[model samples]
Target: MTDVPAHVHEFDWPDRVVIGTVGLPGSRTFYLQARTGRRIVSITLEKEQSALLAEKIDEILDRLREVEGNRYSVPTSTPVELVDNDPLDTVEEQFRAGTLGIGWDPTTAQIILEAHPLPADLDEAEEFDAAASVNSEMLRVKMPVGTARAFTQRTREVVDAGRPLCTLCGHPIDPDGHTCIIPES
Candidate 1:
């Protein structure tokens, strides 16, 4: 990471400070909050560097959010369509032909159709409905388990923090005596 330019305001305030600077490439804005409870730091870049840094920061933040919560163990379910008589053989054939690609696991499968921005005629979307019917195979599509788990955890956290609810029935429960009853199956 590049260092902040000297011309940028560097304040030693006990509470909070806002700094701005303009360098060779672009300008930057920074907000530094020094509190007894928690310290917060936010930085913003201006032009080309801003876009690049924003993308990098977004990726880093996404990974961090995923890691902060224990949400790496969620399985995503995909819809599998069974065609005619032989589902297994058709799925195998599609996989072998590379038309239907599988992800890290055999469960995650997707139609490998090219959709590039060149040769508009060739870029037409291929309809797989007829092919899927004739193939007589089951489509095994899989979703990213880790991503889904992380998202679910994040959403639950947000809901919990914003509006407290009963863990069992999702109803508004008392903050103090919120008992969760688990019925025997």
Candidate 2:
């Protein structure tokens, strides 16, 4: 629609951006939203994708802090906002998320999030970095240290909110319970 190249979309400096989800367990829909002034863009993606992105962001920040000092690592997730945590009340997503990239802009001191459509044949794709670039659809959001930290924390909470896992087996246990056949000792 934009008639532009497949480069990462830019939200150079958004006032706020956070990763969130909607719906209950078994029907949960993960989303990433970026807001700048009155403009807001939301993209949906698989739950695993969100989990991995959040984890990677935290890892990147941690490593950056170790090498560059406290400037980037000083920000930690803030108190969770009840309104933001509730999925039933969030904005309608523009589209489902696909490939995700977390990057740091040293000059601006902001974290960049690039969410794009999944490559047509990811199974045959040789590299993840190449896959994301092949698609023209992308939504990029740039957030400061504190915002990025909050996004990471919130994402973790949402992903972990699924059904509890069985002790013997790793899969989630249904309400009726599970046999959990892990070869008894």
What C-alpha lDDT do the candidate models reach, one value each?
0.28, 0.70
Runs in model 2 deviating more than 4 A are 1-9, 76-90, 119-135, 183-185
TM-score for model 2? 0.76
- Model 1, range 1-185, lDDT digits (tens) per residue? 53322222221222222112222211222111111124333232223332332233234334534564524332332113211111111111111111222223313411111111111133464643423332332222122434323322332322233335667766655545666676768
TM-score for each prediction? 0.18, 0.76
Candidate 1 Cα misplacement greater than 4 A, ranges: 1-46, 68-185
* lDDT tens readout by residue for model 2, 54-153: 8898887777767755765545445354224544234766656656678888877787887776556768877655444545667878877767777788
Best by TM-score: 2
Looking at candidate 1, the ten consecutive residues that score lowest on lDDT are 83-92
lDDT of 1: 0.28
Q: List the residue pairs that clash in candidate 1.
A: 87-137, 108-142, 109-141, 109-142
